[model samples]
Target: MCGRLALYSDFPSLACSLKLPLIKGELTPRYNVAPGTWISAVRRHDGSGQLSLDTLWWSYRPPWADDKAPQPINATVEKVATSPYFRGAFAHHRCLVPADGWYEWLAVGGRKQPHYLTRRDGEPLWFAGIWTERPDGKPGCAILTEPARGVAKAIHPRMPLILDQQSLEPWLDPELTDRETIRHLVHHLPHHELTHWPVSTRVNKPEEDDPALIEPLEPSAP
Candidate 1:
């Protein structure tokens, strides 16, 4: 599950890569974005097929749910289309969540060590997501997760459904609502496309938001 993420890329570069228009306001760098925080998402605007970037609360609350209802941060791709809490949005409100990378904790010995995972090429990562309006009429999104594969399996049993540029358009196209087709489109990034390394434990704290958190953890004193 993608509970924490980092987005430090400038708007111009991110926009260019995502095929989005240059954002008007300053895009603040987020090194330790946590669940429930507002995060950027790309989706097709209603009526028009043009893709636009918008901020969506990281946790997802279904429209029928009360304000006090528990919002989930991640939804399994396999069940998203069938789960009563997510099916409606899954068929109609797909989105792309942009991130520089995400953090996953590895259980080593008796302690958990945090690691940062990003593309080998250093390009931005886009996670598949689904959004819906809440009872208060605000938009919220949940990242889709799949069974962990390859290296990610060593850290956790699940990982975000990271998308390649080729899959973005079809995944976000509201017109293609066929459940079978959508299911087929959902896939994890190939192990070769990703790289991960242990990072400073500072990232374990949501308050520690800086580039240093992504730096490799120093060797222990001998």
Candidate 2:
């Protein structure tokens, strides 16, 4: 489950990486982005093929849902196509949730040990996501998560689905509906291109959004 993530890069830097036109709205760098806050994402229109960077509320509310149930923040690709709450967006409003890194907690000796995962080169990472806007103007999104691989399995059972440049066009293209293509893209990030390390427990708090939360923790030598 990806409950928290980091986005320390400036908007211009993100725009450069995504190769999108200049953003028209104000943006900010988010180090510890939590659910329910406004976060940046690049989404495309199914019919017009228009892509734009927009701010999406970090929680998902189904069109048929009332105000009581918990807003879903993570959507499983395996079940999204059949789920009542996610089927529409799954087929139509796919998006990319950009992040510099993400945090996951490892259960060690009954205690949660925080870990920060990112590209080894320290560049931005993109998580597959879906979004929707209601008639009243409120919009929300859910990050897609799949089974963990390699070292990530040591941290959690699931990790956000990441896409590289080679797969980005297929992932974002509305014309592409082949599930096999999507699965191939979600296989795993190459080990050499990714890295992870332990971090402080301060990241567990949603209010603790700052640079210090990502400082590496010294691991005891074996």
Candidate 3:
């Protein structure tokens, strides 16, 4: 599951990559973004075919859901397209979550070890996502995850569903709603372009958001 991530590129840089209009604001470089917080995403929530970079609460619960309903941060590929809690958003509120990279943990010798995963070329990655309006009227989202591939398999059994660059527009195309049609047009970013390395456990603390947290852990460190 993808619970933590980093996005250091500013609005203009992100806009350039997405080819969308500028949002006219700057965002502080975030090296360790955690859940239950606002994060940037590109989406078209209405019939108007406009895409905007907006901050979304990194957890999801539809407006109709019960007050005590759980807020999920990641939606599994196996169920997102079919689950009652997610299918609607998956079909109509799809979005792209930009990230420089993400963090995952592995059980190593009875302890959890964090690892940083990013494109080997160092280009930013885009995570497939779904959004919905919360009961309080705030926009919320959950990242989509699929079975891990390549080196990511060694770190975890699942990873964020990173979208291929060419699939971006098709993914957000409001007119494309059929599950089979959507799946046929959109594709995951190739696993070969991604790589990972062990990092400091400091990332385990939501409060510790800094560049040093992504630094490769020293061999002797526990």
For model 2, residues 1-222, the per-residue Cα lDDT tens digits are: 888999888777777777655444556777789998888888885566778778899999866677785688999867876787887887677888889999998888888888999898888888989888743467889998888877788888998888776666666767665566666654435556778888888787888888888778866621
Instruction: Supply candidate 2's per-residue lDDT for 85.
Output: 86
Superposition TM-score, candidate 2 onto the true structure: 0.87
Reference-based lDDT, each prediction: 0.84, 0.79, 0.91
lDDT of each residue in 1-222, candidate 1, tens digit only: 889999898777678777644333346888999997889888776787677778888889988898678899999987998999999988899998889999999988888899998888988898999999877677999999998877888888988999877787788878788899976775556877888888988887888898888877879711
TM-score of 1: 0.92
Q: Report the lDDT of model 3 for residue 15.
A: 78
lDDT of 1 at 125: 91
Q: Please give the RMSD of candidate 3 to the true structure.
A: 1.4
Q: Which candidate would rank higher by TM-score, 1 or 3?
A: 3
Better of 2 and 3 by TM-score: 3
Candidate 1 structure lDDT: 0.84
Q: State residue 146's C-alpha deviation in candidate 2, in Å.
A: 0.4
